[model samples]
Target: MSDFMTRVLRRETHSPRSGWSVVAAILVALAAIYALLESVLAALGQPAWLVHPLDALTWIADLPGPYPQILLGAAGFLMALVGLIFLGNGLLPGRRPRHVIDNPRVAIVVDDEVIASALAKCARVAAGVTREQVMVVVSARLVQVNVRPTSGIRLSEQKIQAAVESQLADMELDPRPAVTVKLASSGVIGV
Candidate 1:
């Protein structure tokens, strides 16, 4: 329990709440404060500055026929939508930027960019291809490696796949993501 709290307090916490969630909370707090202030001012028979700017609300109330009904229905719908947004934001987990290889015990957190770049470097070195020819994209569960050979060069996909697999094995990611090697249909002219 203490460890979990510590993680939340840390700046680089793994799964913290989104900024919009905090904004929603602040808005609710401000609304509550305004309501309390207005009530106190009305009780004391004092001039409420907050109430003055809100004279437009009286105009809205005086609206004739279906105008008042329509306005209120729209306002209610908007408020309901906002409530739903806030509820969803609070309930849903954030899109974690870093993957947790080992959690709680060792707590190894690695960024997606780091994994992709490392895979790209390893693929380039193993395949003897220039940086432009090899493109690597690393996700939570998959590593896609695309290789494009120069004209007249027939690069073996098996060799490239094995090299990438070896690199992945060496890293030993916790979740153990799959690797895929694809050869471009047409070779590049210069690169």
Candidate 2:
């Protein structure tokens, strides 16, 4: 039963650009359908109830002589631009769901929110900061920590940075992101 020994593994999937792609595709498709319906209705001598909006579209045909050519040229250019945008989007890689780590047998995939929360907890404990004063953002290449100091309390940037860096180092994140510490100019009123 060599066939029964196969391993089945599934990777997390993400469709970051598919949303915009679908939207652009829908817009193009709707435009084509509208034109087709209008043309069919007009050819068959059907009443203009559903076609009322299409009547407004006659501006393309009614463009005054030279203006018609100019308008059509502009329209063609706009359509081409939209098509190019869609093409670029299709060609580029979308948002990746998870980052690949070093180990081939095992993988570590972490979400931004989770990373931010962990960093916030660490920052609060390490810097003696209140949860309200700590904010974190984890991007692909950076982890930003913004600290709004509590009133009447002074905070040390070095200790916070060291603590955060140590914690991140312990985690052993692949493609480890750089850490940025930003201290707010004014402390919050209450805590």
Candidate 3:
């Protein structure tokens, strides 16, 4: 299987939630609709107060005419501006690229038996190496392994090198061996 496909299959999927911007846009859309309706009612010769509470309040207060229409137009414009900002943010760069995976940490892609056998042999040949101290991770085309050895079982780089190479060779795969080792937590190992 392709590396991308494998990763997808093994990954945990989650449902996405709409952001606050979506909510804001919906509110703005409602406000714009109210503005359009109020304008239409005014054009049809209906009293503005009949369609808008704010217009009725203005009329009760004996406020000068045209104030309500002006307020509604300003409100509509502001709502539209807010909605545009939300939409722009949702589309702009640095706001989460559509295709890229975020913060990918590990890639697991090796047969378990191969890894187990490799680990077992490495532990057996090296005195301090133990199952618990080893962490085997497989990637698309490579295997990464971390090993921690118990105290007092000193190992040298040459010894570790020779042991791992020998164990991998014993696996009898066509590609022979593909493993590397690094000192993880520290136990004496010759460098």
Best by TM-score: 1
Judge candidate 2 at residue 178 and give its lDDT. 92
lDDT winner between candidates 1 and 3: 1
- Cα lDDT tens digits, model 2, 12-66, are 3234576886897798899889777777777788866365445666754666656
Q: Between candidates 1 and 3, which one is better according to TM-score?
A: 1
Per-residue lDDT, model 3, residue 113, is 52
| lDDT of model 3, residue 171 | 46
**lDDT tens digits by residue: candidate 1, 1-191:** 25764464343424566578679779889988987887777777788855742564776576654566787789889999988987877786544554545444454667778877888888888777789999988776788999988888788878888888887787767556798999889888873
lDDT of 1: 0.75
Candidate 1 has its poorest 10 consecutive residues by lDDT at: 5-14
lDDT (C-alpha, whole model) for all candidates: 0.75, 0.74, 0.55
- Overall local distance difference test of candidate 2: 0.74
What stretches of model 3 exceed 4 Å from their correct place?
Answer: 1-110, 187-191
Local lDDT at 18 for model 1: 55
Clashing pairs in 2: none
* Residues 1-191 of candidate 3: C-alpha lDDT, one tens digit per residue: 46775446344221123665578678889888878888787788786744565565568587445567788678889989977876766665322111222233643333545555565557545745555666655332334455666666555645666666676555443223366666666653433
Clash counts per candidate, in order, are 0, 0, 2
